[model samples]
Target: MCDMGQWKQSQHFFEHLLNDSNNNNEDLAKVECSLGEVLQWTGEWSEARKYYNRAYDRMMNIKPTRIKDLAYILFNIGEILYLEGKYEEARDYYERALAMQKETYSS
Candidate 1:
């Protein structure tokens, strides 16, 4: 399911998880992040951003321990922005994501 090469199933699973009302914010965030990755790989930039943003929002609602997931979603956001030719914005997001990753790894 982690393979972007088989994104359709990944997309289906994530979407199903997202629609599940019983899912917690952390769970939804994780699945949304995965969905963002699949959408990104499939060249669905806008859809990818939507999922990334949703994941980020959900991550923000959780504890500080969840920031690593936020960073990952930000990285995907950067990737999408880069593909859209928003290099400066993309770089900013990449830098932010990298900084968060460093902080998480260092802790």
Candidate 2:
């Protein structure tokens, strides 16, 4: 849905998935992150941030943290803050993401 530029449909689909109880934490976290991306596409910064933060927390709690995935999420979080005129906060997240990405990709 998102790849096709169907923002609303993508958001609805992700919301439905989020509401489903069958998904594991890892799956749920990805869905939430995707929903946040959809929201970001629609320019809903605050709502997008909420979902991103939730997804970030869930992903962090999982063992063997997925560094690449975390980097993407952190970058998105930074983007949201940047869009909201929070440059300092955005820089913090962006820096974190950059460090993570560098660490992840350097090896």
Candidate 3:
């Protein structure tokens, strides 16, 4: 939907899920990630970063962390930086993601 320029719809749906009282941290993280992706596709890089960072921070507190998910968010953030011409910053994010992915597959 986001790829089809349905950002508003995707954002509304994710935001609704994010607002659910019964939602857990993992659920919130997923919603945040989805919102970030939508914003990213819409060329709202800064806003996308904010949502991605929220998801990253929330995931940090989760036990038995999901490395691939973390890597995915990191990769998205890196792409945002890459698009903004912040190559150095983008490299940092990309390297982190690469390491996580390597670990995920190695073990």
**Candidate 2, lDDT over the whole model:** 0.94
Error of 3 at 77 (Å): 0.5
- lDDT, residue 70, model 3: 96
What Cα-based lDDT does every candidate model obtain? 0.87, 0.94, 0.94
Off by over 4 Å in 2: none
User: Comparing candidate 1 with candidate 3, which one achieves the higher lDDT?
Assistant: 3
Residues 1-107 of candidate 1 have per-residue lDDT tens digits of: 65537778888878888889999888888888888888888899899899889889888989756767788888889989998999999999999999999988897
Summarize candidate 2's per-residue lDDT along 1-107 as a digit string, tens digits: 78899999899899999999999989999999999999999999899999999999999988988898899999999999999899999999999999999999899
- The parts of candidate 3 lying over 4 Å away from their true place are none
After TM-score superposition, what is the CA distance of residue 98 in candidate 2 from its true location, in Å?
Answer: 0.7
Better of 1 and 2 by lDDT: 2
Estimate the lDDT of model 3. 0.94
lDDT score, candidate 1: 0.87
Clashes by residue pair, model 3: none
- Tell how far residue 24 is off in model 2, in angstroms: 0.7
lDDT of 3 by residue, 1-107 (tens): 77677779998988898889899999899889999999998899999999999999998888899999999999999999999999999999999999999999998
Give the TM-scores of the predictions, in the order they appear: 0.89, 0.95, 0.95
Error of model 1, residue 50, in angstroms: 0.5
